[model samples]
Target: MAQLGNIENLIAARELLTSSLEKSKHLASAIDKTGRKLEEINQRLPSLEAAIKTLASKCSLSEIGRHIDPTVGPAAAVLNVFDAVHMLEESLSADPCSNLFRYLSIVKQLEEALKFLTDNCGLVIRWLEDAVRFLEGNAVVDDDRYLLNLNKCLRILEELRVTEEHSLLSGGCLCAAYGKLESEFRRILMENSFPLPMASSSVSVGEQACIASLPFPVPVIQKLQAIIEKLTTSNRLEKCISMYVEVRSLNARATLQALDLDYREISLSEFDSVQSVEGYIDQWCKHLEFAVKHVFELEYKLCENVFEKVGSDVWMGCFAKVTVQSGLHDFIKFGNTITKGKKDAIKLLKLLDIFAALNKLRLDFNRLFGGKACVEIQTRTRDLIKKVVNGASEIFWELSVQVELQRQSAPPSDGSVPRLLSFVTDYCNLLLHDNYRPILAQVLEIHRSWDHAKFEEELLSHEVHDIIKAIELNLETWAKTYEDTTLSYLFLMNNHWYLYKNLKGTKLGDLMGDSWLQGHEQYMEYYATLYLRESWGKLPAMLSEEGLILFPGGRAIDHDLVKKRLEVFMDAFDGMYKKQCSWAVSDKSLRGKACQLVVQIIVPAYQKFLQTYMPWVQQEASPSRNTKYSAERLKNMVCSLFQPKLGMYGSNTCTNMMGNINNAAINQLSSTPAAA
Candidate 1:
């Protein structure tokens, strides 16, 4: 069975081998056929590739159709040249060394195509006409769509730049496109409602707010700038600047007119003159600031960034000069308004506003000119700013002097004092409390030379010093004019004391030197002495020999004459007390001392007279009974002179009266020897 199986296996193997050989033969035939076919394909590959490249160069009429206008019937064929050229570019990218000839061939073909289109094809002209019409249509639209056409036109110009025949054509188109762009921009400017919507966060009001809102929208300006940036020539810049100038001039005129009209509405008589002037000045300053800042930040910013960037020197120069001149003109006009009045005091306050504006202008000028291309213009404007500041300072000095002259009119009395003080107080507070340090310093120089090294010891404000001096002088002179010596002294003492106390109370007190206090003290002593002499000096005359006999006489002492003298002394005492009591002496210590002095002089003399004549007074009961001023009555009356409310008193009057009798006698006799 194994042998039989081996024989069968050998037979099967033989059959399998026979089948494998047949299959191998068939596979060899198939391989041979495939190898022959591949060899044939390899043989034709170069020609096939060249034919495919040629077909690729001419295959897409669709793409060509997209680029060329349908109106250009035959010139549409010229679009095929671009395809050929594109194919050559691809070949060149793949292998420049191998495809140099091909590239040259396609370039020659492109030239031939262009020449044919230019010479024989009306379709090329039709295509250009259609493109121009499309550009015109887009330009006419009041929107951003024109930018697309503008970009397309620029591309066309770039594409035609290499071709001499078409280069002039592009130039014409550029001219037309630029004209269209200018006309569109002009239209946009003319039709645009300038003064864009106010920001929701803005706090501006009245015409200022309106003016602030009047600037063109930022996006609009950016768009216009973008369009202008495309233009490269100086002549184009001139045209653009001309349009810009017209628009800016119109806005400026409107702004100025509006400002003037609003200013006219400010009625100086409607409010406190000083306050009103200040308000008007502040408002004017605000407007000026707005105008100046806008000119630099907005208008000039637009010119520099948008127009001047692409502008000619002529246009930029003219624009800058006009802008600066316009600002100066406005400033001059505003300054004229403030200076129109003869009252230089009012003008001084107004100059504060003007100076502030000038300072702001200086800062703004630096900011604006810092980035400027022109240094000469910057330096010139800087000098102009300095001139303005110096002019303003000069005006301020002149006006300050004039104001001082006006203020120095008549010396301030009680009626006129408030006005003077009000001015002084305001100016002083402004100089000290407010941050007007430089102005204060200048004012000090104008008014008086103060030692800055002695700032702490110096008077706080020179203006205040002047006012105080004036008031003090006037008060002293007025006091001197009083005919009554007592009243004059009393007035002087009261006013001077009040002034001294007030000086000590105020901020200005620290500035008053020790010399001032010392001098004031001497004045106080002098006035006190004068008052004592005027009031107390008369008391001794009333208590003369006719009034009271200090020594006793024999039998008849002229008791009726003595009684009449006593009556006269009583009458004098009552009148003097009434007059003096009504008068005011503000210093408490001074008043008390004055009272004591009067008492020392009069009381002791009366006490001595009464004591020397007490026995005589006891004997002469008829004379004493009829007398209104007895020894006790006179003592009570003398005490009441010091205490006006204290009427008649009893035994204590005599005791108290004689209590200080020795000291009073010595003082009275020593002080007033004439009376003794």
Candidate 2:
């Protein structure tokens, strides 16, 4: 009996191996066949160029502009476009990653060129027909050459449509390809939608701005960009609606899972099944990945389509649209959420997927980690993951055994994600503050990889340094003066806002730090400290008043120099976007109100507040600078000034999303870095 059992087990193992291998082989074969078919299709596409040349040669050459050669100039442009469309089709037929995101950038240019030609194709052909009829009658010599070029264009159009039909059908498959693939798939889709990343990049920033030198008029670029803005707004609205639906669905599912409906105590059967909870995890992973694929795919397509319609001019267009009171409002909303719990979301998603994979593996095999086939892999994977997650119960579960005193009356925070988010946001706003204009310039220089040393030499002046000093001083005062327990939140908000405002105006790759927007979320929990529970004052008066803001306890800050520097800096920033970037601002047709909000608000309210109020508070120390005192304190200032507290709070109040991000990030840096 023992011998028979051993033999049976060996046979079962062999059968499993054989089945896995066969499936792999079948997939491999299918992939290869698809690749060959795609290659065959691509080989047949460029033949249209030959047809274009054939037809063009049949017509007499133009005396004006050269005759259309299917492969060069506009004809070449047409030929290249058709050729590209064909190749993109072939590539998608094989795999989305075959050429990666390469063809995406060209797709927009091709579409626009094709549409213009397609619309005029019949007209060009009709004109040629008329010219040919005149030739039979030996008519006017004036229009012959013009007719010849139009005839060649019509031929190029005829050849283009054949490929166009093939491309549209082939490109549709890319939706599925992208929905399934990872790695550059979304970016590729965006490239297809908007091909402006290239042209806009050519516009050198600072004094030598190439954007001003475009052969196309500035208004043309602006107009093109506006159309794209509408496209993007529509796309974003649709995506937001879709995302809300997904979030709502996910929330509903979670509610169902947490029903515990017999609410008295937990049921043993339902609880017992959770001992092997990986099964539920695995199920969620499958569904969630599917959902992400769809969501990301949709977002990519939406953005891409917008870009294509707008060209490189989209950012300029975005600059205009993003400034409307409503646009700025929505941006702030997203900025707030991103600063809240992006990290926690990323962590939980990965954890869920891994646990799900582990569960599915265990069910498939009686013992995965302990077995000869899986032992080494499972052990290695577990150790690596354990190190990364570091005490998983703290991250994943609240009910697990713990020594630390958990908050007493608060409902399990998993359910109070918003409040928990508040804690996280609060800490950030109190910690991370940024120097916007300087940071923006530095990041942009980094992005352009221009003469960094020279750029800094030219960009940073004594005035800029003074502005930095003044901003830093007041910012430090804000960080130091407040006795509020939730002071850290103020830091987080400013930092997030400053980063977005400054950097968003510049191109990517200009900043020294990673664009946290790319992959790893800025961890909200890092900012999550129990604020109200801890009775810490916002900033010590010692640090706020006497302590130099710049090198607070570290170096000397010339208080006089700081004031003048800041004034010059603020004036420069005021003009930077004055005539260059605004459109909606009835004030100036410059650009970027995002940066304006931070600079204008931060400079006056916070930067100059200490400059103004601190002197009034300390009557003996009052001397003269250009700074004016607006009351000894800001206590009744809001009431004295514009609108009194309209919200529930008698003092100024924020409606969560109505709060700030730039201040939050600034708070993060100030509280921690100097403390070190």
lDDT for every model?
0.47, 0.32
Best by lDDT: 1
List the candidates' TM-scores in order: 0.44, 0.20
User: Highest TM-score among the candidates is held by which one?
Assistant: 1
Query: For residues 1-676, what per-residue lDDT tens digits would candidate 2 score against the true structure?
Result: 1222333443344333322324434433443453344345335435643543454446443421232221123333333333333333343444434443333322333344344335433333443444344343443365565445445555555655444333335354333333323223333322333211112423321112111111223443333234334324324333322332333233323322332212212222332222123233333334323222332223323323334454534422322222221121222222122222212212333343443333344432232123343343345445433422332212322211110111222221111111222333332222122422333333334433533333443342332233223333333344343344233333433333333333332322133235543211242222222221231121111123333355746554556554544344434433432421211111111113323333333334444445543454344354434334232332232122211123211211122322322333222222111010
Error in Å for residue 660 of model 1: 58
Candidate 1 structure, TM-score to reference: 0.44
lDDT of 1 by residue, 1-676 (tens): 1222233343333333322224433533443453344345446545644543454356443332234333232322333332332332233233212333333333333334334334323324433444444435434344434334334433433343344254125453224445655665676566653533332334542333433443456666655665565443314666766776777666555545545435534333343323235556666666667666664456555555455455445435545654654443444444544443333233344555555565657677666554444455566554444433443344333423333434334332211122332343334334443444464344434333323332221343454466556556555565655567677776666555544554453445555555675677678678877877877677767656653443566454656565565666667777877766545443455556666677777777766665655566667747555345654564454444332222221112222322322221112111111110
